[model samples]
Target: MSIQSGQSAIEILGPEQPESAAILSAQALQLVEELAERFNVRRDELLQLRLEKQAQIDNGKLPDFLPETASIRNSDWQILGIPADLQDRRVEITGPVERKMVINALNADVKVFMADFEDSLAPAWDKVVQGQANLRDAIRREIDFTHPTTGKSYALRPDPAVLIARVRGLHLDEVHLHWQGRPIAGALVDFGLYFFHNYQQLLDNGSGPYFYVPKLQSHLEARWWAEVFAYTEERFGLQPGTIKATCLIETLPAVFEMDEILYELRNNIVGLNCGRWDYIFSYIKTLRNHSDRVLPDRQAVTMEKPFLNAYSRLLIRTCHRRGALAMGGMAAFIPAKDPAKQEWVLNKVHADKELEAKNGHDGTWVAHPGLADTAMAVMDQYIGELPNQMAISRDSDAPISAQELLEPCQGEATEAGMRANIRIAVQYIEAWISGNGCVPIYGLMEDAATAEISRASIWQWIKHGTHLDNGQLVTVQLFEKMLLEELVTVREELGEARYENGRFGEASELFRSLTSAKELTDFLTLPGYQILTQKTVA
Candidate 1:
């Protein structure tokens, strides 16, 4: 492998000691530099294209199936055959790339552990670099964690789940890495470093450098990743198509182009995940101009809703048609300590997974290790003795339309729902800003995407002048009043002392700024990243 660019040195602007020593070796940095030199330009161009597309949406051009990609959509094509290690993903567990969580998740009874470097992770410099070190140790089964005070130790079991790393989206930039004075794309930094260090080792262990690509907006973005995989294979002297990716159909534009996306990454992508939370956020942002698109309560927008029902069926049909796995979204519920509540949540999870399995999802996502057994049980029942449900096809009598996918829920919006949204936004953001991206709140594991949709729903409600079922108008004044009231509720919930020191004020203000701005922010994390980095530098 040779560097095509006329550069010999790679500059890492971040710290160079300790944790960085393990993952950012000279060879690994070379791979990252090569990836940046080759793909970073195209990444920037694609992000700009996203901005242009959003402008068109703002100008009343609603998102729909692309006419230009009609040939790709209508054509007969399938992605490369499913890789051996990824063929039976009955239940997949996901969490941030943290050490203790890494050891526990891998040991859980699941087929795959998607070590997320994206929404589930807070991208502080120390955390980001340390996460890479953790993943490297995990892949080698050399990971162990000791409780600082309790003196308990945690380690990987004899056999662990297959690891699939999810990198940051294209829009984020890793400021600690620079190429010719420009920040390197965070996606490249995460994917390149991980693959550079582990691809060969994984192959030696009968697996490959698998990934869960997040927040992709279109087929072109999928094509970009396909090219990246091709280039990486060449750079590392590996067989073509050794890397397998699962693109998250999280964005509205992506939902319309699922078939085209799989066609673009036919050589590298093996599955498609229904990123439900981010999908809702994308729905609100995409149709923010239309008053009818204002969503009801967040809780009311479940998988059983019409839009989601169509999305699930359509996803299953699209993936099976192309010989790819249709992975389900996260069931964020965690078992509560209260016995009655625990049973209720577990039943909910079981029902959720049952629906997916019956609808022919090959696999599903569980946010906690505890839910693995329930999810696996449901999958086992529907997919008994079968590697996957890829053979299943949609019946001729049932067909989904673009309009069904676009329709909003008929559930009523309530004042309690509004308060819950604000409460979650504040609580989740507080946890996020403090460098904890995934928080278990009210028995549910809330991540950045959950918080995003919470705030986006509020914004859409206020903008559309939506009225709650109780006859109160959802005006800016009402929202502000509710915000103040919820702040008090949050303070009381967390206690006065914890509230004072917890950055609740900062979280509240940040949530307000994002949701109340005249123009919607492309991503809540973009500004939230600034706060995290600033706090770390201080």
Candidate 2:
């Protein structure tokens, strides 16, 4: 048997047995000597590994349990393989009961969809295998998602966004668990083994997984994942580069180690996502509060200007350096209601497209499928066509360098696009207050956390760039000037009038309304607004 530190051992009856046996006996002696030299210095690791090998053999499993490890290789972190452009792609998920959403999204031409087993699912532990069972039984034979016992059927069937983990060949799904949420080094090998087999099944379907690795802490974390990934070749008998991974740089630590993360997982890397809401929370909770940095209100400090600019630029550079696709984060949901709200969602999507396209991102996520058309339309609008090295053009006379066309699109988007998006964002905000969701944002979605997400959407846009509207771009300077001239007065007048009788339910309802509005205005009231005005004048 093979052993660590390059050693082996065996025994025989006599030194003068058959020729082969004697030769084997001598080789066994040589192996013992090597083992003595290598493992003699160590007591437990060598002995324990041997014992595990014995157990595997006795159970008719592994003939040899060799350690599969490797250092990082190939520095290609181009996130270009993403299914859609970062700014415009709609990535709605089907809940355990939401399969139809996937078809609906597809019918509308959304860029991507996920069958979520993480947050959207409540997979019971005892029935842990059920999740994979549901996926496999459905993937292979197309079983109904109806709970036979309950006689209740799911409206939407599961759609695999990343590969379905543990579904032979669907292992990349587990990347999110290991890389994203939290780091646990040892459990990773187990996870890798479980997913490797899934890749085989994925190949059967003529598709391979494109994973989203969540919550990566640093370049080191990405590196470790790469190491485990290398072992998959042996685990499932696949080519070296068959599997792929994309890290979600959500945590604060990950932001600092972008280059490392990109460098380490470069070969297998897809692209990085702009995880705004969670990232902001981490930015506030980990960097500011945890580190004892006194901060203003969370909502007040829009991550638009210097922060998002620097961060996004870094992401763009990192991806471009390796020719990987760099994706922008989600534009959250814009509740549609008024014409103004429609305009706001349109503005945000287009502006997001502007920022991403300008920064070199290829794709982004749209949270709500109902709003998929708006996001997809924005992407369709901005992405004139994929970059082609050979000569190609929509109009021969209007030809321009691809770089030239996308150059000015970097910072701010068109004015018309911005105005339209802003209206949609406003409409999204109005939805909770006045739209169709069961709860009003200001009315019911009053939790500080939910309210904060709503607030950040608007402030972030204004802070980053002046949004666009039907041929009019609202530059930050113009937006600021307008706030000085008109928006702030309206806000103050409304805040005072509303807060005069702002009881618990009243304030809560206001927050609920904010969610429905799909605009950040109402949430920008209360504590969040003060934080913005106090120190973020820039």
Candidate 3:
């Protein structure tokens, strides 16, 4: 199928769906094609710069504040004023754009709901188009869902949470949509479709189009987005800053350039979020070649770790000083069924939010609706009736240095941790390839970021030949042994019929290849997308 965009055509490789016409209309395709043609070359350049920077890190140069951007960092500047709907974001819930998940997330008692098309979504072609339709219906108050099995019904409440759409990262490509004989940037397709279809309705309802930009590695990337926003606003004859964005400071190099990033998008950005899970993954990937910087078990690297704590504190300081909201990280724990276990989960969430609140964060993210109240209560206690804690600049605190932000966490990898990593990565990858992304596993919400950490940590450990706490050395042979044992354990946990029906074989093979490769794979999704596309074709 092909759609005309001016004189050009966008070739659609995926099977057509009922919502395809409405979401992928000629006008929307035009916007996507224009954005891709104008900005994709710069996106390619920035991605190449990432590899160059990684080469420097591999050669022993640690990341630090840029000397060139010192003027912007030292000079006083502020992001444009945040809109009223986004002011009281004490608690925000996030999920994929599946129909039921969309309805439930928006109706939850939170200040905002980030409808994600990025990490939490599997990005199947049908799901991607259907997700756009779902969000458009939701914005117009026409979306509802009926459970296929339980016969339950769901509809949006009277005043739903504020909606923010997160587009895909620069590194991903929407292979199903080709422009000029190449795949369009996934980021453009997500942003262009959502913005084109819903901006007017959102503005009519007194909320302009809002967004969450993910996986950026530099200020130049931020500038690329800023230019896109400016061009879109001008094209639509809307006011400048009509599209407010909150960028995720998830990459290790981005932490050092927070001020610069905010400055580049100052007119269109409202805040910066601590995308902690991806940040940890970035920590490992950026320092994969540094023997002394090896991290311990994933569980051991908590927010209280010196490097993570320094990152949080510095983000708070920098954002508050520059008049941008400093949002906290995710509370990934899902409530357990058992009463005692549920209490323990809530307590962990409470403690985590308390740390973020005390450190002067204006908001936090929760993966489950069950967690929203707990996160909100903690933020309320610290912020009182205030919309946010922006007034608390943390000016009196000691400056966080590069060494602290890069501090090597002190702990040893355990056999249990390694086993758990193998299990989670395999199971999550299986689910992802099966067209589900947000999954509940072992009482935690597991998404692409956590799965990346799981596999990447093991790769880093094996690459460095580190010793586990059990006095076992990490090697390809040991990893393979554990892989087989873990599969057996998983097979027993899940019955034979279910195991046979699932995609564990493919998942395990992919995981094994990733962890045993000569160098760490940048993202498992890069390879996993191939499997997904092949499965779709078959």
Candidate 4:
């Protein structure tokens, strides 16, 4: 356990663990220690606030915009202008921070590349440290890789995409790096190490340190980041606005507090993104106890749905009204092996991007490099040389209410949905356990958050006794039956040799553990993290 330091305390459950000494050098450790000793308490307090809020929600308290911050919402205010590099971000590509991925994402023909250390990464100790090293090399244009067998060498372009590093959320901890026998917050470790090492180098190359803040739940969390940025800039002798960030309004509560969230980080924030998958997971978790709020099949939740549309429009309205870019959601579809299927998927992505562009989104996200051009072309058609579509009036007439945003999708749960939830959850968890956070499953790039959605949806359905359109109820017996069937399908798909070698059995157990719990688990990765670190897959 951590010893008390004045008012701050961080306790480590286990004894000191060792990993990643390169990124945990004396100087980097000092910076991380400073952040942990100062802000870990506040982080804990905010997390406690989350629990309290969940309790209120469990008791049937529907989330709404704060009455106290109503004036802030109604007031006309804008974030400080963004750096020039970020101005025309029509399309942004995102991926894990492996060396090859870093190089490819930077060299891709996109406006920005989000080097993700969060959802798309498994966050093993080596990955955490090496991902930092990878980003540093990419920033310096020193990153390169040669395919082991293909004899093909890859390098960065002369003008790579603008880089934005996304650190982990506040709930995670870097157990490998400890300060005075206590683990530091993973967010601090990730953002601090990257910022401490590469802030100046990025600025020297004509871009500053930009970020995508993930999984923020309220304005207070945004305020915490603002304080961190202020301290970091002052500590590193950079200008106050040297760091620009885009917050992902991924949580249901955050959707309500969008304006307030931007207000807290007003000077440093440049945009807000729609974290569609995590938002759905959060929605399910938030309303898990409320039978009336149960959602339909995962495929049934589309952007055109009422709740999602309301959320997206409200985000655009909020960001544009504040002079911040309102970025669109991720196009998760990857290319299928068949050319016809790939073309169909690309066209679907084009339509999605077109809707976003027409709806006044300044930028959008794509998971694969192949879709970047498709997304950008759609944006080009709608935006037409403008950096963003914020000047277009998008939300003046169609005002959204809290009820509209909270309104659940009207569709029946089906056996297909349940089977898909099981199959996807098991496959994703298996891949995740193998240290891959993002996998192209059924031509869509799925991360741990998608697995969360699957398991949480299953849990909610079983808990609420949701009935399918075909008149079958979502019960434990039915779920178990579907899970067994999906397991057989997964085995056959992977082939016997590969199935036995991978972590499918363990993944199935993990998925069952997550969904069959009496209480909703907070994060699918939390328990899986232990499994990942403890064992090595063959």
Best TM-score among the predictions, by candidate number = 3
lDDT of each: 0.88, 0.41, 0.93, 0.86
- With a 3 Å backbone cut-off (N, CA, C), the pairs that clash in candidate 1 are none
Instruction: Give the number of the best model, judged by lDDT.
Output: 3
Q: Candidate 3: lDDT of 331?
A: 92
The digit string of per-residue lDDT tens for model 1 on 104-167 reads 9999999999999999998888889989999999888899999999999999998899999999
Model 1 error, position 345 (Å): 0.4
TM-scores of the candidates are 0.97, 0.50, 0.99, 0.95
TM-score of 2: 0.50
Candidate 4, after superposition: displacement of residue 125 in Å? 0.9
TM-score of 1: 0.97
Q: Tens-digit lDDT track for model 3 on 1-538?
A: 4444444477777877899888888888889888988988888898999999999999999999999999998998799889999888999999999999999999887999999999999999888999999999999999999999999999999899999999999999888888888888899999999999999999999998999999989999999999999999999999999999999999999999999999999999999999999999999999999999999999999999999999999999999998889999999999899999999999999999999999999999999999899999999999999999999998999988899989998998999999999999988999999889899989999999999999999999999999999899999999999999999988998889989999999999999999999989888888888887774431
Candidate 2, residues 141-210, lDDT tens digits: the string is 3545556588776433344333323111111121111211221121232233224334556667665544
Candidate 1 CA-lDDT value: 0.88
Query: How close to the true structure is residue 398 of candidate 1, measured as C-alpha lDDT?
Result: 73
> Lowest lDDT 10-mer window, candidate 4?
3-12
What is the Cα-based lDDT of residue 500 in candidate 3?
Answer: 97
Q: What TM-score, to 2 decimals, does candidate 4 have?
A: 0.95
Which pairs clash (backbone N, Cα, C closer than 3 Å) in model 3? none
